[model samples]
Target: MLLANLMAFMLFGFDKRRAVRGMARIRERTLLLWALAGGGGGAPGAFAARRLFRHKTRKRPFVRWLWLIAAAQALVLAGWAMI
Candidate 1:
């Protein structure tokens, strides 16, 4: 989880930099996949950076899906804990 978060954070930061330079952007699905694979903590930081950088803020799908993914992960964890 720690390693995944670090990777996700770097990916987000890198994506933000790329956006500023008008370079090819990272795919939203890639970011979501990282978050789903235990990088939820870093995912929020990515979204924050996107907002701060004025990148992808208008994309409703990314924001909505990430929120859903986080919520689903939380519910799954809670369910597991209750077992």
Candidate 2:
């Protein structure tokens, strides 16, 4: 999770010009996996990156929702694990 967050932060902090494009599908799916693997914050980090970088923010609704759902799932998983 911490690692995922770190990667997320890296993904966000980097400039879009340095970003890897033409891989929206792959990147989105990868982010989803990271979120599912206990990296909930990664989703939002990606979203914020997209907004800040203005890259692929409005490309695919499905991927966006997938990230949202992944974040939510991670929250639930964490909550459940806490108890």
Candidate 3:
């Protein structure tokens, strides 16, 4: 989880830098996968990097996916707690 969050954070920041440089961008699915992995492991680090890096703020679909991942993680945690 810690490693995943670090990777995700770096990916987002790298993507943002690429965007600013008009270079090829990272795939949204790749970004989301890292975010999901990070969130699944109980760290919002990717999302935090999102705010810190100002990446994907204007992309509604990406934001929705992030929320979806968070909700899913919450549900999973809630279910685990009930076990």
| lDDT (CA) per prediction | 0.71, 0.58, 0.83
- Of 1 and 3, the candidate ahead on TM-score is 3
Highest lDDT against the true fold, candidate = 3
Better of 2 and 3 by lDDT: 3
Ranking by lDDT: 3, 1, 2
lDDT of 1 by residue, 37-62 (tens): 76234555555556666666777988
Per-residue alpha-carbon lDDT of candidate 2 for residues 1-83, written as tens digits (9 for 90 to 100): 66765665455444355555533333555655543454344565555656676765655774667566765867777998999
Off by over 4 Å in 1: 39-55
Candidate 3, residue 69: lDDT? 82
Instruction: Give all TM-scores, in the order shown.
Output: 0.76, 0.51, 0.87
Candidate 3 lDDT, 8-81, residue by residue in tens: 88988999999999999999998888877843542377788888998898999989988888788878879988
Q: In model 1, what lDDT does residue 72 have?
A: 79
RMSD value for candidate 3: 1.9
